[model samples]
Target: MIKRLINLPEKSSFFLFGARQTGKSTLVRENLKNGWYVDLLHSEEYHLYLKAPEQFRRNSVYKIEKEGVTEIVIDEIQRVPALLNEIHSLIADYPGTRFIMTGSSARKLCRGGVNLLGGRAVERRLHPLTYLEQKENFNLETALRFGTLVGCAGKSEIETQETLAAYADTYLREEIQSEGIARNLAGFSRFLDIAAARNGEIVNQTGIGRECGLSCNSVKSYYSILEDTLIGIRIDPYIKSVGKRVSAHPKYYLFDTGIANALQKQLTAGLDPVRRGRLFEQFIVLETYRMISYRRSEAELFYWRTRSGSEVDLLIVKHGTIQAAIEIKSGTSVAQPDCRGLRDFGQNNPDVPLFLVGAIGQPFFLGNVQVLPWERYLENLEQWL
Candidate 1:
């Protein structure tokens, strides 16, 4: 398996969040050498923590102070979120110990539950392997088709597809039911399949409701559950006073294309690279989003579009100012249409960085935007740090 970057925080209290089987436990275990693990999924541990949160904290503290105990790994921490408040107090009392907390779901965590970091603990999201992770041996051409989860380029297309499908059934399906995201497995599963097939499109709740045989409100609520559960997300259009013509509909995207393909019933492939360019861009958008949040950067991801034809795929606004305008493309053809909207945005709003992220090799300056591949852009993430 590919390893997480070596630079993430190991000494501080960490709450690792991700979809099930995305390697939350694996990453934490591999990095931790001295932590005592508390598997709350175990019935005894769950009852113990739920019954006496104080005692749970004592167990955690005892582990921390033991001769060999250097840290504490609370697996499935969300199972008993009440322990977070106790953990918070323990951190105050025992500042010497480190913590490596892992959870498969974030539904409660994001709402600022009691024991969570609440601005104190650093939050890290462990997503499935990215393009970079499996790039060493994977085939770039086929991997590009599904975007990269593990750079499984050397693996046959069938094997890679099966892995993704298994992840959907084993991790996503299990997590959803076990965590009570939806009581109806059949309807929810149908939603997943439909959303994946419709990935990379602007969808209103009403349309999805009609397709899924659910009410509009039900569709909206389901989408929220997905966003919170870390399965899929919808990015709203950047609304500004640009006045003349900007589309207001938000674009929806599956969290990972590999996951998207597994949920989809059919593959939509065209020989023309530009034909599927938008989907490629959407893949980059999701990666950029996860990478930003993984780094704990305080940025919100959105896209910009006009009522007519002017558009930009991704926009980053921070601290009340539009900091960066990003446009995504399939290849590196250094042309006007690819760079026009980004350059125009930068020209209209000076001081903001304009960027064009694509799959094409090499990097160059095109007007106000720096045109570069997804990998090249990631190398400079520290600059944001």
Candidate 2:
């Protein structure tokens, strides 16, 4: 089994949230082997808890008092948010017990106004497999093409495509439609296609709404649904004044490239140069996101762009200071012209380090900008900041 980068607290009760199939259950089961495991997805357990939330408390108490159980694992905690109150009380009653709650979506818990344990539980997220976790078996081309989801690992090309396609369908049926997150499934489906097509570009909600026959506010809500479900993340534009007109819109990236491709019905086709480039940039941004999340860094990610078309792909900001300005490229070779965005960004943020990351084999310097291979950059991402 591939080891995930997230380090769960040993003593503290915590909530693990991730999109489905990201391996939250597997990770928790592997680490907390002696815990009392409750699978909420099991219809019997779900209906029982849905009928009597106190039964969860009763059973938990019995296990703790008579069975000598010190750890309890509740899978898909969001399926029955009422259990949280019971869990909260249990935590207060039994200080020795550790509650490991896992959820595929936080929409119900957040919107339903359920008890969140009063800060008694720390929260951690699990993302799709990262290169660091895959190590020797990692393939850049495969990752960029099929994505790094755990389900895609070690599978045949056709099988991987099938997995991604099924994932998209499952997400729509279970997370969106069944959960009633989107009232109009057809409109939301249309919006998803447009969103996947415009993956890395600045979000134009109005334009997307027009195309999908949805209001701008509806589009925003749909985007929130995606975020709450851990299906994607939004990268806001860097807003620090740099004597240039900057775009205010944010860009949304699907959690996995394969999911994006599957949503767009491009999984079986060969990715053209333009599509490949976008996927490459998305891959690097995702890696940066995973690394920052796994390391629990205080840094936040943003993209720098001006109305004049000069743009830097990513910026690492920490404590109100720009740590690094990075431009992602899909090319194997870099030239002076490719550093234009970095140069433009450096003129205003001179103190911040500049980097141009791409498919190059070695690291080199193009003026003040450090050109690095994508892998090398991710391996030593902390040093750059």
Candidate 3:
């Protein structure tokens, strides 16, 4: 398993929520070393919760307290929602007792909210493998080529891509449909395909809903379902400077590039080099964003598009300051015209770093902003911050 860099506070209890296979369980077990674990995923106690919740509660409290263990991990806590309230009460009364609740969905958890905002459980999101974490396993070239969010690499790119594509389908089957989030399972499956196809692009939910014959509200709710399931990510528009002509819509990104490719059902460029490169660019920006978010860094990922025509692929803001502006070109050839967003953003915030993040020869001066290749883009992220 790839070692997750996002560290949990050793002194305080927090909720670690993420999609299955993102290594939440592995991270906690490996890091905590001594927490008493109740794997709700494999427990008969989970079925008991569905039937007789009180019995499940009785066993948990007795199991933890009787063992004299203060730290506890309840895996797949959403599976046993009623246990949350009692768990909260356990932490509150014991004070010394700490609990870590992990789950993939919030819908069932919300419905089972015996307590809201989890007064005691601090909720934090665990995203898919980031560029930084995967560096130790896959080389920088492989990661950049595949982008982020693929699983099981074989000896060859063909074999690796095949494995990842299969994983994507299995992920949808296991996480989305089987999780029982959307009542219309078939519709949600189609929606996944559409969302994956449109990943890294501005989403028009109302239009998508109309096209899919789902209500706008249903589409919005379904988007939340994806968020809860940890399949999709949305970057809100950066509207801090309203005087500039800015686009009003947010952009959507899938958590994994393999999933995005699987949804589109195409592994390689085959012959269309241009299309493959664009997809590669999208993958890089999204994974870079995930790396920042997973670390609990204070940055919002956004895209800037002017009213007339100019556009920037990524605009990262840190605590109200425009920290970085980036444009993505998949190939080596880049011109001054391509640096429009960086120049424009620099005109407003002169200190913020700017870059064309793709296969652009080297990191050099493009009017004060840096220009670097995609292979080295992630490494430069820390420097920007």
Question: Model 2's lDDT to the true fold?
Answer: 0.89
lDDT of 1 by residue, 67-123 (tens): 657788889888888888887887777887777778867887766445465666887
lDDT of 1: 0.70
lDDT of 1 at 25: 71
Residue 50 lDDT in model 3?
67
* Winning model by TM-score: 2
Segments in model 1 whose C-alpha atoms lie over 4 Å from true places? 1-3, 41-58, 65-68, 111-114, 117-120, 131-139, 145-159, 241-248, 266-276, 331-355, 361-375, 380-385
lDDT of 3 by residue, 98-192 (tens): 78888766667765445643566677777666757766675644553444442344347887677666666776754566666777876777777
Q: Could you arrange the candidates by TM-score from highest to lowest?
A: 2, 3, 1
Error of 3 at 311 (Å): 0.4
The parts of candidate 2 lying over 4 Å away from their true place are 241-247
| lDDT of all predictions | 0.70, 0.89, 0.70
TM-score (C-alpha, index-matched) for candidate 1 = 0.81
Task: Name the weakest run of 10 consecutive residues (lDDT summed) in model 3.
Answer: 146-155
Using all chains and alpha carbons, the TM-scores for the candidates as numbered come to: 0.81, 0.97, 0.86
The candidate that achieves the highest lDDT relative to the unseen native structure:
2
